[model samples]
Target: MLKNLKLTTSIIMLSSLLVLVAGCGSKKANDSKKEISVALNSELSSVDVSLAMDNTSSDVMEQVGEGLYDFTAKGGVKPALSTNKPKATDHGKKYVFNLRKDAKWSNGKPVTAKDFVYSWRRTVDPKTKSPQSYYFDGVKNYQAIANGKKAPSSLGIKANGKYKLEVTLDRAMPYFPSILAVSASFPLYQPYVEKQGKKYGTDAEHTLYNGAFTLKGWNGSNGEWSYVKNKDYWNAKHVQLDKVNVKVYKTEQTMVQQYQAKKIQFTQISGSTVKNLKKDQDLTVRKIPGNQYLVFNVKENKLFANQKVRQALAMAVDSNKLTKHVLQDQSLPATGYVPYGFNNSKTGKDFAKQAGQLVQNNKTKAQKLWAEGLKELGMTSAEFSILSSNTETAKQVDEYLQSQFETTFKNLKVRVAAVPFNSRLSKQNSGDFDTVLSGWTPVYADPTDFLNLLMTNNNNNNGKWSNSEYDQLIKDANDKYALDEQKRWDNMEAANKIAVEQAPIAPLFYISQVYLKDPNLKGMMLGPLGQPYYKDASYK
Candidate 1:
């Protein structure tokens, strides 16, 4: 049972690097100019939307790459490039999309239906090795191509004409439209990507934009980039801000100081700053649904093979203390894999309660389980190393866990190893650590968005925990013959229950997003998935 759990966590830490823009000292001085100044936590690796995986990079690319569909302010799907909702036929196995004739790239090229067909094929191609390729499994024949059993063209997506796209699905996906809004499904200009070769999407001049904003002076790897209004955008007149100046800061304190000095319009508050700025009139505190967890490398470590040991370690964690004391925010303690407010079903509620029953804060029980687990493994003392990013929050969490575990289990020696953020992420992806701190941002609003990440074969499942029963349940949930909505949800709930019972991951806490924005900023809508969209955002 310890081999089937998949864990995902989300938390933003403070960093110190800042991008200093030449000129533009004050907002008043730039009032006459048409530019919006924004601050981010890190430097963007690339402006290419499809290649980006992290929130910091994806948020920027969302502005440059408009999807065929987009999420509305109310969290519903809205058409972007498509003229209307897709037409389903052949018992929900096939879908046909009619494109808007006015949709065109910033370079004045028509946004053809073939662009999507090419993009989807490129994403799932084995050679491309996209981290997000797992999302395509729902599409018909995608798994076959990924597994080398079928040709790329065999995947059920094709252009009916220049402006019509036909897509075939393995089953009826309720959240299919929402999936289309994600960057991975966004249309890619095949001609442009091929013509520019390595330079494509590396800079403003290297690519074309179809969204409200077009890249101005962005060199993909640079700390500073600018977004100008796209003249060829279909709804260009609705774009209020003329230009958006983005600067990257690696630390929270640096960004806070810049925000205080009015160097930038917004920044995320962290550490001691959260306390001081809680009462500030300009600060805004919001709770997001993503959670953080400690993933155990069960495949690599023998000790983690025991379910009792995993459960004991999980019970020893005091998530309430970590969220309230260590990180002074109203972060919710995670009791289950699927966050509260995300879904409501009889099966989901039952499984959540069952999972919650496993969490215990008593050290005595933890010691008993630890001793039994060690005896089962024929060991006296168990020493293991945990990896965390070299940030204040990570260090504090690591210290908290280390102290708690030491007090609970006398025969255990858990060492905390801290590394830079990027290096830590790389090691986690490679499964090079016994345990690692990590988080997940939902690409779309669905239970499958969270459940699919933990599948044994999922790229995001760094721990490689596999379970046949869990895989079968997910397969059944996505099967088209399962017409009952509640029945599908039941299958998902059962799968999540199996995941929690496995205990390969210890759920920590749900992250709360804390931002310091100017009072004049209006129409800023934050979603449960990630950062809010800026298209409708404007100054009062």
Candidate 2:
């Protein structure tokens, strides 16, 4: 076994932490190798894509589920389960997909086109209460089904034959192919899902794999899990790794210790430990196409209901200092909700730079706004607590924000509710908190993915921010401007401006995926959405 490797400074990466040392030739993969172990910051709860919106679930889904398309290293779309790209017709509103004949479920049943139809319909079904169903908005009748005006079966997706699938959209979409690459659009075999009932996706046994890996040894609560290669995979001959193992370790110290002890190949490190990593040759810092922000529950908190209060709080955030000192990574201070890396469809310049700064440090203006907001509400004092994940890095950022707010406004009592990641998501979704730190990554490469969430009644809009003008702008961007590339791009930028001005969510910083990877690992392509594809990855 090629166990020991000394890291040099010749590593390469793009948006996420996938590195390969320069001048190292590829080596033949040894299929008899044991599972490759890595660290996960949070626990893996579900492989059901509809119910699980978090990153860990998405990671697990990629191992077990195969989508119509997958992403390439150049931020481009590529075919996965389908033989190639879908054929577009009806002015790009209709897409026909041809599945590979060899694709089969872990149970030895052929993976048919109808599996995609059933899985998509199940996601948009009102009974499922899927938080991620909003991803289907532009699909034909998807919004109607989600809004309870149409039946789930009415969703405009059908299997044309045993191997061909047809998808009808409400309008022509330029980024539809990219959207299909996300985990939310993947298929699930119908019979197994029905047999397992609600317990499906809760553990390894209940779920079946159709992708490159078959998950095993996870009982839904264990901190350790493994992804064994699927022998029945259609392209199993190309899958280089025999198995990949994951262990949940929240402490940065433990991850570092594990890596140094040669027990793992990669781990994410943050805080002061970043200083230590700069000297280590294995360090590779990469930006993820996402932004961290704070969402407020306007319906529950009267103070937060006032736009002036929200704006005041937003302007007072000093993200530049936070990213520089606290995060200590190469993360940038976010100018708006949309990430900085996305290119404008018209000008080809950066989207975030073109949109400009939505909110910034202006203590005097913030103070004036706060006073006006308090007077409008006829109150002198107000208090609110922030809900945040309990990870070490999250704790540092949350503590910084709490101290800043409490010190800035004497009348405002700011508290931090640090809970486990799953608990935090539950609390935020139920509208049980005054404020919470959250984030969103683009499902595709389009700016609309981040901008559309603030539209009226969007599923992820837990803040209950309703603005008719903002909603109209988003509608025009996704609907009216669908055909004109420049017009749609302009509308998306305008919508993000409205979201920033209203301050329902305060943009903080663009999150970076920091990795300490072994130099020998090759062919791991980290997609624009922060997912790593290891289909062709192998040790050199």
TM-scores for candidates 1 onward, in order: 0.87, 0.92
Q: In model 2, what are the clashing residue pairs, if there are any?
A: none
Off by over 4 Å in 2: 1-34
- In order, the Cα lDDT scores of the candidates are 0.69, 0.76
Clashes of 2: 0
Clashes of 1: 12
Please report, as a residue range, the 10-residue window in candidate 1 with the lowest summed lDDT: 1-10
Q: Kindly report which residue stretches of model 1 are placed more than 4 angstroms away from their true locations once superposed.
A: 1-33, 195-208, 216-222, 345-358, 480-482
Model 2, range 214-274, lDDT digits (tens) per residue?
Answer: 9888998886777788988888999988877777777888778767666666677776777
Query: Measured by C-alpha RMSD in angstroms, how accurate is candidate 1?
Result: 5.5
